[model samples]
Every structure is written in structure tokens, then in C-alpha cells.
Target: MSTELLTYLFVGVTFTLYIGIAIWSRAGSTSEYYVAGKGIHPIANGMATGADWMSAASFISMAGIISFVGRDGAVYLMGWTGGYVLLAMCLAPYLRKFGKFTVPDFVGERYYSQIARVVAVICVIFISFTYVAGQMRGVGIVFSRYLEVDIVSGVLIGMGIVFFYAVLGGMKGITYTQVAQYCVMIFAFMVPAIYISMLITGNPIPQLGFGSEVTGTGMSVLEKLDGLSAELGFAQYTDGSKSTIDVFFITMALMVGTAGLPHVIVRFFTTPTVRDARKSAGFALLFIAILYTTAPAVASFARINLLNTVSEASYKELPKWFSNWENSGLIAWVDKNEDGKIQYTAGKSFAGKPSFTDERGESGERLINNAPTEGVNELYVDRDIMVLANPEIAGLPGWVIALIAAGGLAAALSTAAGLLLVISTSVSHDLLKQNLAPNISDKQELLAARIAAGAAIVIAGLFGIYPPGFVAQVVAFAFGLAAASFFPAILMGIFYKRMNREGAVSGMIAGLAFTFAYIVYFKFVNPADNNPEHWWFGVSPEGIGTLGMIINFSVSFVICHLTAPPPQHIQDLVEEIRVPSSNNAAAPVEGGQTANA
Candidate 1:
């Protein structure tokens, strides 16, 4: 069968499976909608968390960024994976023990303030929206390529599917759906890596293949990549360009951000016990590591294949994938100097290079300038297209390419479901049922959750149609916001008995304000001001969250010491969460109890 037909078959099958799972696991109550009735097995919840954590950024974008950036990309691998350890140890179990349906529920009860809960709801909404936008965009990219639809149409299709499943099943449907999604995404990601590895280095495992010598060239993969990078005027693959401090802080930011992410933390709440929550985190990390470890190998393989395939090739002689991507507007080439030979290098501009003229050809196609320039650079490749294009670039089988299409959609949709849940739960449970409409029935709340989820999907779809930035960059900003606003407050609430509502609320607001201001100023107001030299304390925008986190911790502690300590009963509630006793574990509730321990 043709690639298009194969893609349709595979993607169609996956969609059918997702819809079936959603229907099978349809939720009946608010508890079922919010926490899957708190009956998820540790292993199952772990797999679900893995799927939730590994969004499009991990599945579609990480390898692509790593392929071009090389060692610098290690931060993403380490930062994202390492944060799970913190979640498992410092946050997940305690939050799960608190037995609340939402992150803001814990914050509100823990701090004993409606203001604190509202603040948390705002933070969760902001972070979740920022993250979901990228997932929506990922869905669009996959659909645009595989289904041959425009991005807006692709986003709408995705929104429709997610709305059907997520609104119907809520957390229950999303969890089971994610379990299947994890399997599909992992298989799709691994197969191409293994195939490319065997083709390049005669090794089946991508990690091993990345270190092995090329089959014919007899040079190690890294050595060959370094040589090619030098030849092409790009940085060596083994070396990184970021400063040490920037790398340190960015990694720290991602680590804390991962732990603080409301969606990930909410997954632990689905587990039955605190011990299960901890165990689930371990299993989730293990599953995530499968793809995380394979990604670098895939990056190495893609870099090698791309350079070998494109370098010094004439425009007319280039492979079919070249023209395919070019037609998609992701890859561009101009025959500068009219030599007809393609030059693929860094820092090349399309301006003053080539332009389409008004004149028409015999076929009625617009005629463009074909004159070649003396410069040896004529191509521009968007990094985001690397992974999706990798299978084609390597001449993989049609079925394999189709599987990747399903995998990308799964990755994007699964995480989008998870984030939308956080958004909806925050609005319905935390904002409405808990604070505003305390007497609301469970049935009413369930309807509100569904409505909120549908609204969130529409907003997420709009963001996808007009993305604020690249997938990874927007996600990094979300992480920054999470790290600054949520991590410190949650951690302090669990670890420090003296922490009071006044301090916790103040810290969250300060952190959220500071991080949001910095990101907006650099990313939107003055993009030129994002350089290292201009950054406060030399911290890049990606790493600024670490500083914001510190500010939160410092400000909260200072204010806590200055003000009266938390009431004795609140301290007892803190002690109760710290201990893992099953007897003390509170029953999961919409409006959780005040600190009456």
C-alpha cells in the first residue's frame, strides 16, 4: 500500500482504539471523573503518568532538538527525568496522602485560605494552558503530514476527539487511554531508532549503535558526526554551546518544574495509597527512561543520516524526502550562484538568495530565479520537522512511517487530555464547587467539569492554530512558571510545619508574577533582549525559573518567620501528611476538610 493509505489505516486504528477505551471507561461520579475513583493500580497509574509526562515535546521535538544541538540537549534528558525522582520523594506521595482531587485543593486546605486556593488555581490554569497549546500544535503537525489536512483542520479534529473522550471519561477514561497511548508511542518511537541503528552500525539497539563504529566507514558515530559538523561549519556534536551556569539553572528549573506540574502530581492522586504513589513514580520514570535513553541515539543517527544524505548533493539529484519536505514549507533551498548544487549549512538566509517571479512557465507555474550565488549555503531546515521526517529520510518502510504518525498523535493527545483535566478540575472542583458554590451537587459539578474541559479544548485548539512559539520553547516557559509558582509552595507545605497561609500565598503570587514578567518581557516584548549579556545575573529565560523558585522560597520563609506561625491544628495536619499511616489518610473529597487534625 502507499504511504498515505498506510498512514490512514494505522492512525484510524489508533483513533478507534482510543475512542473504544474512552467509552469503556466512562466515568459516572465526580470521584470517577476527577481521580478515576482512586482505584488505579500502581503499575497502571505509573504507565499513565509516563504517558502524561511525555508530551509532544518529548515524543516529537526532543530528538529533533538533540539532533542539532548535540550535548546541549542533555539538559532536557536529565532535567525532565531527574525531576521524577523529586516528585517521587518530595511531592507525589505526600500530595496523594492528602487525598484531594486537585492540586489547588491541597494548597487551599493546607494553607487554610480561599485566597491561597484561588492563587493556585490561577497558576495551574496558566501552566496547563501553556503546556496544552504545544500538545495541540503537535497534534496538528502530525495530522497535517499524515492525513494531508491543514494545521487548523488537524487541530479541530484533535480537539473533537479529545473532547469526546476526555469529557465523557474524565480522569478515568484518560488514564486507561493513556496506558494504550504509552504503548503505541513507545513502539513507534523505538522501531525507527532500532531500524536506523541497524542500518548505520549493524546494531539493533540504538543506544549501543550510537557508540558503535559505522559499518563501512569504521569511525565511531560520534567521531563521524564531529567530522561532518566541522566540514559543514556547525558545532561539534559532542560539544555544547551553553554556558555552565545557564545549563545548571535550566536543568534545575526543568527538574523542579516537572515535580511541580499539577497534571503529573494529580496522576499520583489516582493511586490508592501513599506507598503506591511512590512506587508508581518509580515505574513511570522507568517507562519514561525507555524513550529518554533512546532519544539521544536517535538524534545521533538522524544527524549522521541527514548530513550524509544532503551534503554536496545537487538539487535535482536530492532524494524524494528533500522535495517532500520542501513542498511542505519545512525545508527550503535556493540554487544560489545558479550551480544547481544544494548547499546545506548554518546561518543561511532566504532573503536576497532567490525570489519567485511573476512570469509563468509552459505549465503555468510561476517561474523563479535560478541564478546561483557564490556562497555555499542554500538550505534552511526547521528542527521541529526532524523526527517526523527522519523515517522518510532514511527510506524506512511505509508501514513504519505510518506507525510514527499514530505515535505522534498519541503522544500529543494523551498529554493534552491530562492537561485539560487539570484545567477543568481546577475550574469545576476548586473554583466553583469548593470556593464559590459549596452546596453544588456532584452531578452539577460533573457537568461543569465536562463543560470546562470542552472550553479548554477550544482554547487549546486556538493556541495551536496560532502558536505563541515553538513547541519546546513554549513548554519550557510553562515549566518555568510551574517551578516558580507551585513547587516551592507545595514542598514547603509538606516539609515545614511553620509555613502559614500568609507566607504560602505571598510566595506563590511573588513567584508567578516574577516568572511571568520575565518570560513576557524577553519572549514577547523584546526578543532581542533575551541574550545572555542582558539577562539578570546571566540567567537565560529558560533558567530564570530557578531564580524565581529561590525567590519564592526565600520570600515565603522570611514572611513566615515574621508573621505568627501556623495554628497548632494546621501543624498537626502537616504531620499527618508527612507520615504514611493508612488510618490518617483522608478520604478523597471535592471540598477537602480544613486542617482539623
Candidate 2:
């Protein structure tokens, strides 16, 4: 079958499976809607959490970024995975022991203030909405390429599917769906990697292949990559350019943000016990590592393949994949220097470039670029297209390409659903039922949650259609906001017995305001001011969250010292959460009821 037909078949089958799972797991009550009735198995919840945590940036863009930046990209791998260890050790079990349906619920009750709860809700909504926009954009990129639709239409289709499942089943539906999504995405990611590895190094495992000698060249993969990079004026694959302090702060920001993200934190709430929550976090990290480890290998292989295939090749002699991506506007070649040969090199100038025009004669011929210039650098490649285009570039089978399409959609949709759920619950449960409408019926709350989820989907779709920045950039900002606002508050709530509502609320507002102001000023107000000279203490906007987090901790501590301490009962509650043995294995239901396991 053709690639298009194969893609349709694979994508259609996966969508059907998701819809089937959603229908089967529809939530009946607010408990199920919020936390899957607190009955999900540790292993299952772990897999679901893995799926929820690995967004489109993880699936589609991570390898691409790593391919271009080499060792400098290790921060993402370390930062994201390290955060899980923090979650497992410092946050998950304690939060699980608290037996709350939402993060805001824990914060509100712990601080004993409606203002604190509202602040937590605002943070969750901001973080979740910012992150969900990227997922929707990932969905659109997949659909637009494989299904041959515009990005807006693709986003609408994704919104429709997610709304059907997420609104109907809530967390219950999302958990089961995410488990399936994890399997599909992992398989899709690994298959091409293994194939490419075997083709180049005679090894099936990509990690091993990366270190093995190339089959014909007999040079180690790293050595060959380094040589090619030097010849092409690119950075060596094993060397890094970022300053040590920047790397440290960026990694720390991502780690803290990962632990603080409300969607991921709420996953632990679905587990039966504090012990299970810890165990589930381990399983989630293990599953995430499978892809995380493979990503670097994929990056190495793609870099090698791309350089070998494109370097010094004439425009007319370029492979079909070149033209395919060129038509999609991902790859552009200007034929600078007027030599028909395409030059792939770093620091190629764009001065005196000519306008592109079709030069086909009556014979109906076509060329990628009709413009010619004196510049040596002639091509522009977008990094975001690397992974999706890798299989095609390597001449993989149509079915394999189709599988990738399904996997990308799965990765995007699964995370989008999880974030939308967070947004929905924050509005319906935390803002309305808990604070504003304490007497609201469970049925009314459930209805409100569904309505909120639908609205979130629409808003998320709009953001996808008109994104303010790149996928990875927006995601990093979301993490920064989470790190600054939520991580400190939650960490202090569980660990500091004397932490009062005044301190916690002030810390959250201060952190959120500081981080948001820095990101907006650098990213939107003055893009030119984002350089090192303008940055505070040489920390970039992405790493500014680390500073913001410190500010939050310091401010909160000073405020706590100046104000009254938490009440004795509240201090006892903090002790209760800290001592996991005091709580029951199963989460308590409404009205302080516990169901039998």
C-alpha cells in the first residue's frame, strides 16, 4: 500500500482504540472523574504517568534538539529524569498520604486558607494551559503531515477526540488511555531506532550501536561524528558550549518543575497507598528511561545519516525525502555561490541572496530553489522535523512511517488529555466546589468538570493554531512557572510544620510574578535582551526559575519568621502527612470514608 493509505489505516485504528477505551472507562462519580476512584494499580498508574509525562516535545522534538546540539542537550535528559527521583523521594508519597483528589486540595487544606487554594488553582491552570498548547500543536503537526490537513483542522480533530474521551471519563479514562498510548509510542520510537542502528553498525540496540564502530568505515560513531562536524564547521558531538552555571541552573529548574507539575503529581493520587505511590514513580521513571536513553542514540544516528546524505550532493541528485520536506517548507536550499551543489555547513552567510523563482521550461521540470547567491551556506533546516522525517530519510518501509504517525498522535493526545483534566479539576473542584460553592452536589460538580474540560480543549486548540513560540520553548516556560510557583509551596507544606498560610501564599505569588515577568520581558518584550549580558547573574530565562525558586523559599521563610506559626492542629496534620504509616493504604472517599481494597 502507499504511504498515505498506510498512515490512514494506522492512525484510524489507533483513534478507534482510544475511543473504545474512553467509552469503556467512563467515569460515574466525582472520585472516579478526579482520581480514578483511587483504585489504579501501581504498575498501571506508573505506565499512565509515564505517558502523561512524555509530551510531544519528549517524543518528537527531543531527539531533534539533541541531534543539533550534541552534549549541550544532555541537560534535558538529566533534568527531566532527575525530577522524577525528586518526586518519588520528596513529594509523591507525602502527597499520596494526604489523600486528596487534586494538588490544590492539599494546598488549601494544608494552609487553611481559601486564598492559598485559589492561588494554587491559578498556578495549576497557568502551568497546565501553557503545556497543553504544545501538545495540541504536536497533534496538529502530525495530522497536517500524515492526514494532509491544515494545522487548524488538525487541531480541531484532536480537540474533538480528546473532548469525547476526557470529558466523558476524566482521570479514569485518561489513565487507561495513557497506558495504551505509552505502549504505542514506545514501540514506534524504538522500531526505527533499532532499524537504523542495525543498518549502520550491525547492532540492533541503538545505545550499543552508538558506541560501536561503523560497519564499513571501522571508525566509532562518535569519532566519525566529530570528524564530520569539524569538517562542516559544526560543534563536536562530545563537546558542550553552555557555561557550567547555566547548565546547572537549567537542569535544576527542569527537575523541580517536573516534580511540581500538577498533572504528574495528581497521578500519584490515583495509587492506593503511599508505598504504591513511591513504587509507581519508580515504574514511571523506568518506562520513561526506555525512551530517554534511546533518544540520544537516535540523535546520533540521524545526525550521521543526514550529513552523509546531504553534504556536497547536487540539488538535482538529492534524495526524494529532500524534495518531500522541501515542499513542506521544513527544508530550504538557496544554492548560494551559484554552484548547483548543495552545501551543508555551519555559519554559511545569507548575504546577497536572490529571490526564488520557478525556472522550469516547457518540459515541466522542477527544482527546489531557483535563487542563486555568492553565499556558501544555502540550506535551512528546521530541527522540529528531524524525528518525523528520519524514517523517511532512511528509506524505511511505509508501514513503519505510518506507525510513527500514530505514535506522535498518541504522545500528543495523551498528555493533552492529562493537562486538560488538571485544568478542568482546578476549575470545577478546587475553585467552584471547594471554595465558591461548598454546598454543590457531586452530580453538579461532575457536570461542571466536563464543561470545564471542553472549554479548556477549545482554548488549547486556539493556542495551538496561533502559538506564541516554538513547542520546546513554551514547554520550558511552563516548567519554569511550575518550578517557581508550585514546587516550593508543596515542598514547604509537607516538610515545614511551622509554614503558615501567610508565608505559603506570599511565596507562591512572589515566585509566579517573578518568573512570569522575566519570561515575558525576555521572550516577548525584547527578544534582543535575552542574551547573557542582559540576563540576571548570567542565568537565561529558561534557567531563571532556579533563581525564582530560591527567592520563593527565602521569602517564605522570612515571612514565616515574622508572622504567627501554623496552628497546633495544622502542625499535627503536617506530621500526619510526613508519617506515612498513620494513613490508610487506600485513599479516603468523600465525607472521610474509605473503600475496602
Candidate 3:
């Protein structure tokens, strides 16, 4: 079959499976909708968690970022994986024991204040929307290039699919649907990686192939990539350009942010018991490792394929995938020296994003009005397109390319469903039912949840059509927000019995405001000043969340000490959650382990 037909087949089959799961597993009550009735098996929930955590950022854009940034990209791998460990070890079992439907539920009850719930709700919505924007835009990117549709249409289609399943099944449907998605995502991601690895290095294992020598060449893949990079005025593949402090900060921010992400945290609530939650966390780490370990290899392979194909190649003679991406507007060329060749040197191709005219140049290249920057580089390839285009770049089979399309969509949509569900819960359960209309029925609350989900979908669709930055970058900002706002509050509420509502609320507000303002100023208000030179204390916008988190902890700690302690009952509850009882010999212990005390 043609690649197009195969793409339609794979994507159609997967979509059908997702919708089928949603229909079959549709929630019948508020408990089911919010936490899948807390009946999911640990292993199944673990798979779902992997699917939820590995959004477009992990599945589609992570390797791409690594391919381009060289050494700097390791921060994502370290931060995200480490953060999950923190979440599972430090928070998951305790939160599951709390038995709340949402993070706001835990916050409100723990703090003994409705106002605190509202603040948590606000933070959840803000962080979720920001993260979902990346997932939706990733959906658009896949559909735009693979299905040959505009980004707006792609996003609308994605929103419709998500709306159907997410509204109907809620957490129950999303959880099962995500199980299938995890299978498809991991398989699709690995197939291409394995194929390229074997083709390039004669090794079947991607992780091993990353270090193996190139087929019939004396040098290793990394050596070849490093030499090629040096020849083109770029840094070695093993070398990173970011400062040590910046890397540390970004990693720290991502780690804590991951720990505090509402969507990921909610997965723990679905497990039947605290023990199950801890078991699922272990399962999820095993599943997540499959992709995370292979990402670096995929990055090196893609960079090698890309450089080998386009370095100083004639525009007309370039592969069809090059033109395909060009037509999709993800790749732009200007032939700066009138050489009619595509150059791959470092530095920006222009002062800003390409402002393409409707006209074609002499070599049939799309004309860009953007002024050329001081660089010999003549190509502008979107990093988001790197992984999606990798299979095509290496001339893999049509089915492999089509599978990539399906996998990319699966990754984006799974996380989108998870994020939207939390957003819906925030509005319907936290705001309308808890705060606004305390007398509402369960049925009424369910209806409100569905409506809130629909509205959130439309808003997320708009963000998808008009993303603020690259998938990874936007997600980083979301992580930073979560780290700054929720991490400190939850950590204190669990660990510090004296923490009051006033302190928790104040810390969240301050952390969120500081992080959001910094990101906005650097990412939106002054894109020109987003570099290290203009950063405060040499922390880039991406790493600013770590500092924000510190500010939150400090503020919360001081205010918590100054304010009156929480109610004695609340303090007793906190102690109960952390301390294991003798009757329960295998009770869930602190840091996600079991012990008889």
C-alpha cells in the first residue's frame, strides 16, 4: 500500500480502538469519572501512567531536541525521569491514601480551607492548559505533514476525537484507552529506531547501536557524528553548550515539575490501594525506561541521517522528503550565496521565523521575506519535524513512516486526554460543585464535568493552532509552573504538620506569579532578550522554575512558621498518612516502599 493509505489505515485503526475503549469503559458515576473507581490493576495503571507521562514532548519532540542541542538535551531525560521517581516515591502512595478525586480535593481537605482548593485549582488549570497546548500543537504538526492538512484543521480534528472519548469515559475511558496507546506509541517509536539502527550500524538494538561503529566504517556512530559536526562548525555530539548552572536548574525544575503535574499525580489515585499505587509506579518506570534509554540513540541516528542527506546537496537533487517538509513549511531554504545547494551550518537562517512569500525562487524554493542573519546556513528546519521526518529522511519503508504518524498522534492525544480530564475536574468538581454549588447532585456534577471538558477543548484547540514555542520548550514552561506552584505546597502539606492554609496559599500564588511572569517576559514580551546574557542569575526561562520553586519553599516555610498551625485534626491526618500501623504489616511506607513497623 502507498504510505498515505497505510497512514490512514494505522491512524484509523488506532482511533477506532481508542473510541471503542472509551465507549466500553465509559464512567457511570462521579467516582469512575474522577478516579476510574479506584479499581485499575497496578500493571495496567502503570502502562496508562507511562502513556500519560510520555506526551508529545517525550514521544515526538524529545529526540529532536537532543539531536539539535547536542549535550544540552540530556537535561530533559534526567529531569523528567527523575521527577517521576520523586512523584512515585514521595507523593503517589500518600496521595492515594488520601483518597481524593483531584489534587484540589487533597489541597482543600489538607489545608482545611476552600480558598486553598481554589488556588490549587487555578494552578492546575494554568499548568494543564500550557502543557496541553504543546500536545495539541504536536497533533497538528503530525497531521499537517503526514496527512497533508493545515495545522488548524489538524487541531480541530484532534480536539473532536479527544472530546468524544474524554467526555464519555472520563478517567475510566482515558485510562483504558491510554493502555492501548502505550502499546502503539512504544511499538511505533521502537520500530523506526531499530530499523535505522540496523541500517546504519548493523545493530538491531537501538541503545547498543547508538554506541556501535557505523556499518563498514572504522569509526563509531558518535565519532562520525562528532567529526561531521566539527566539520560544519558545530559542537561535537557529546558536547553541550549550556552552562552547568543552567543545566542543573533546568533539570531540577523539570524534576519537581514532573512530580507535581496534576495529570501524572491523578494516575496514582486510580489504583485500588496504596500498595498498588507503589507497584504501578515501579511498572511505569520500567515502561518509561524503554523509550528514554533509546532516545539518545535515535537522536544520534537522526542527526547522522540528516547531515548525510542534506550537507551541501543541490536543492533540486535533494530527497523528496526534503521537498515534502518544505511544502509543509517546516523546512525553508534561501540559497543565500546563490549556490543552489542546501547548507547545514549552525546559526539562525534569518533574524526570526521565516516570513514566506507565495512566490517560488529560481530553484523552486519557497521565498522568505525574513532578512538573512550573519551565517552561512541556508536551511530552516523546525526541530518539531525532526523525529516525524526522520523515517522519511532515512528512506525507511512506507509502513514505518505511516506508523510514525500514528505514534505521534497517539502520544499527543493520550496526554491531551489526561490533561483535559484534570482541567475538567478542576472546574466541575472543584469550582462548581465544591465552591459554587455545594448542593449539586452527582448527576449534575457529571454533566458539568462534560460541559467544562468541551469548553476546555475549544480553548486548547486555539492554543494548538497558535502555540507559543516549540513542543519541548512550551512543556518546559508548564513543568516550571507546576514546580513553582504545586510542588512546594504538596511537599509541605505532607511533611510539615504545622503548615497553615495561609502559608500554602501564599506560596503558590507567589511562586506561580514569579514563574509565569518570567516565562512570559522572556518567551513573549522580549523574545530578543531570551538568551543567557539577559537572564537573572544566569538562569534561562527554561531553568527559572528551579529558582521559582526555591522562592516558594522559602516563602511557604517562613509564613508557615509565622502563622498559627493547622487544625489538630489536620495534623493528625497528616501523621496518619505517613506513619504505618502495626496491624497492616505491609502498609505503604514513605517513599513508595513497604515495611512492617
Candidate 4:
């Protein structure tokens, strides 16, 4: 079959499988909807968590960013992976032992204040929505290319499909679906990596292939890339351009942010025991490393392929993949010198990303409204397209290319569902039933959760259509928000029995406000001044969360000293969680409720 037909078949089949799983395993009660009835096995939960943790940002955008930014992109890999370890070690099992339905549940009861719960709910919504937006954008990118639809239409299709599964099945449906998604996503990712590795270096393993010598060239992949990049006025593939402090801060932000992310944290709550949470976390890391380890190799292969085919080449004679992406408005050529040859050198082809016009140029390339800049570079390629376009760029099999489309959708939709569930849980369970209504029945709350999820899907779809930045960059901001707001509060709540409601609430508000304002100022208000020269302490917006996290920890500590300690019962509960004894695990909270209840 043709690549086009194969793509449709793969996508259609996967969508059907997902919807079928969701319908068959749909939730029937609040317990099922919120925490999968706390019955998921460790290995399965780990696989599901892997799928949930690796969003569109991981599967689609990470490799793309690495391909473009080269060595500097190591921050994302380190931060996200290290953050998962922080979560698994410091947070997951304890939160599971705390026996709360959501992050807000833990916050409210631990602080002994409804107001704190409300604050946590606000943080959850902000963090989840910001993160979900990237997943939606990833969905739109995959659909726009393989499905031949505009981004708006692709987002609409994704929104509809996600709504059916997420709103209907809730956590129960999502958990099992994610297991399948993990399998599909990993297989899809590795297949192409293996193919390209064998084709380029006579090695089947992508990780090794990354460092192996190219088949004909005596130089290794990085050496060849360095030479080509030097010729094109770009930095070496192995050398980083970002300052050391900035890399440190960004890495710290991502690590702590992963620990604090509401959606990923909640996955542990679905497991049956504290030990199960730990086991699942381990399993997830193993599964996630499959793709994470291969990403550098995939990136190297793609960068080499891209440069070998297009740099300073004639536009008309260039491969079909170039025009295919050009027509999709992700890849544009200006023919600036009027020499009929494409220039793919360092620096921007224009002032910003291309603003494509409805009309095409004399050579049938997408016309951009942005005026061409004064440079040898005449190409503008969206970094997000690197992974999706990689298979075609390397002339991989039709089925392999089609499989990537499936994998991209699986990765994106899986995380979107998880994030949406967090939003729903926060609104229906935390905001309404926990604080406001307190008297609503389980059925009413379930209905509210579904309604909240449906509304969140629409809002998230809008963000996908009009994303603030590239997928990885937008996700980094979400991580920054999470790092600033939730990580400190949760850490102190667990470790410090003296932590008071006043301190926790104040710290969260201060940290979130500071980080959010910083990101908004640089990324939105004064994008022109977003360079390192104008950054505070040489920290970019992506890394500002580390500073915000310090502020949170400090503020909470000072406020705790100034205020009375948490009540005796709350202190006992904290001691009980830290003891880690299953026999005495059920610590009592206010209203005679057991922590494990």
C-alpha cells in the first residue's frame, strides 16, 4: 500500500482501539473515575504512568529540539528524567500513603484548611492546562501533516476523540488505554530509530549508532555534523551555546517540576499500596528510558539527513519531503538571492517564524508575509517537524512513516487525557465537592467531573490551535510553574510537621505569582527582550522556576516560624506517613477520617 493509505489505516485502527478500550472500561463511580478504584497492578500502572509522563513533548518535540539545538538540549533530557526520580523517591509513595484522591486533597487535609485546598486546585488547573496545551499542539502537528488538514481542524478532531474517551471512561478508562499507548508509542519510536541507525551506520541500536561512524565517511556522526555546521555558520553539534548557570537552572526547574506535576503524581494514587506506587515508578522509568536514550541518536540522524539533502541545494530538485512540509506551512523557502537555490544556513531566514500567506510563489512554495532578512539563510523550518518528518527525510518504509503518525497521536492523546483528568478532578472534587458543596452525592460529583473535563477539552483545544510557542518551549514553562508552586509546598508538608496552613498557602501564592509573572514578561510582554542579556542573573524564563522554588522554600520556612505549628493531630499524621509502616499506615485526619480512607 501507499504511504498515504498506510497512514490512514494505522491512524484509523489505533483510534478505534483507543475508543473501544475507553467504552469497554468506562468508569461507573467516583472512585473509579478519580483513582481507578485503587486496583491497578504495579507493572501495569508503571506502563500507564510511562505513557502519561511521556507526552507529546517527549515523543514529538524532545527529539526535534535536540536536533535543532544540539548539545544544549540535554537540559530537557536531564531535567525530565531526574524530575521523575525525585517524584518516585520523595513524593509518590508518601502521597499514595496519604490516601488522597488528588493533590488538592493531600494539601487541604495536611494543612487543615479548605482555603489551602482551593489554592492547590488553582495551581493544578494552571499547571495542567499549560501542560495540556502542548499535547494538543502536538496532536495538531501530526494531523496537519499526515491527515492533510489545517491545524485548527486537526485540533478539532483530536478534541472530539479525546472527549469521548476522557469524559466517558475517566481514570479507569484512561489507565488501561495508556498501557496500550505506551506499547504503541515505544514500538513506533524505536522502529524508525533502528531503521535509520542500520541505514546510516550499519548498527541496529540507535544509542550506539549516534556515536558510530557514518557508513562511507570516516568521521563519526557528531564530527561530520560539526564540520557541516561550521561551514553553515552554526554552532558545533557537541558544543552548547547556553551559559552554565542557565543550563543548571533549567535542569533544576524541570526536575522539581516533574515531581510536582499533578497528573503524574496522581497516577501513583491509582495503585493499591505504597509499595505498588514505588514499583510502578520504577517500571515507568525503564519504559521511558527506551525513548529517552534513543532520542539523541534519532536527533543526530535527522540533522545529518536534513543538512545533506537541503543545504544550499536547488529548490526544484530537492526531495519530496521538503515540499511536503513546505506546503504544510512548517517549512518555507524564500529564494532570497533569486538564484533558484535554497539556502539553509545559520540564523533566522526572517525576523521571526514564517507568516504564510494563502498564495503560493512562482516556484509553488508557500508564500510568507514576513519580509526576508539580510542573510545567506533562505529557509525557515519549524523545529517541531523534525521527528515527524524524519522518516520521510531518510526514505524509510511507508509503514514505518505511518507507524510514527500513530505513535505521535498515542503519545499526545495519552497525556492530554491524563492532564484533562487532573483538571476535572480539581474542579469537581477539589473546588466544588470538597470545599463548596461538601454535601453533594457521589453521582452529582461524577457528573460535575465529566462536565468539567468536557469544558477543559474545549479550552485546551483552543490553546493547541493558538500555541504560545513550540511544543517543548511551551511545556518548559508549565514545568516552571509546577516547580515554583507545588514542589516546595508538598515537600514541606510531608517532611516538616511544623508546616502551617498559613505558610503553605502563602508560599504557593508567592512562588506561583513570581514565576508566572517572569514567564509572562519575557515570553509574552517583551519577547524582543527575551535574550540572556536582559535575563535576571542570566536565567531564562524556562529556568526562572528554580529561583521561584527557592523563594517558596524560604517563604514557607519563615512563615512557619512566625505562625503556630500545625495542630497535634496533623503532626501525628506527618510522623505516621514518614514511618512507612503498612500496619499503622492509616493516619487519622479531621472529622475522624483515616488518611488511607
**Model 2 lDDT per residue over 72-97, tens place:** 88888888889888987889888888
Model 3: per-residue lDDT, tens digit, 1-597?
A: 999999999999999999999999999999999999989999999999999999999998999999998889999999999999999899988888777789998898889889999999999999999999999999999998889998899999999999999999999999999999999999999999999999999999999999899998889998998999999988898998888999999999999999999999999999877778889999999999999999999999999999999999987787888777876678777777878788879776543444544324322243435446567888787889888999999999999999999999999999999999999999999999989999999999999999999999999999999999999999999999999999999998888889999899999999999999999998899899988999998999998999999999989889888999887777877887787433434433333443222
Best by lDDT: 4
Candidate with best TM-score: 4
The model with the greater TM-score, 1 or 3, is 3
At residue 369, what lDDT does model 3 achieve?
Answer: 53
Q: How many backbone clashes does candidate 3 have?
A: 0
What's the TM-score of each model vs. the native? 0.94, 0.94, 0.95, 0.97
Error of 1 at 67 (Å): 0.6
Better of 3 and 4 by TM-score: 4
lDDT score for residue 63 of model 3: 95
Tens-digit per-residue lDDT, 157-251, candidate 1:
99999999999999999999999999999999999999999999999999899889999997999999999998988889999989999999889
Give the clashing residue pairs of candidate 3, or none: none
Q: Candidate 1, after superposition: displacement of residue 201 in Å? A: 0.8
List the candidates ranked by lDDT, beginning with the highest.
Answer: 4, 3, 1, 2
Q: Write the per-residue lDDT of candidate 4 for residues 51-105, one digit (tens) a residue.
A: 9999999999999999999999999999999999999998898898888899999
Which residue pairs clash within candidate 1? 336-372, 336-373, 337-372, 337-373, 338-371, 338-372
What are the Cα lDDT values of the candidates?
Answer: 0.87, 0.86, 0.90, 0.91
Alpha carbon lDDT at 438, candidate 1: 92
Return the lDDT, model 3, position 400: 97
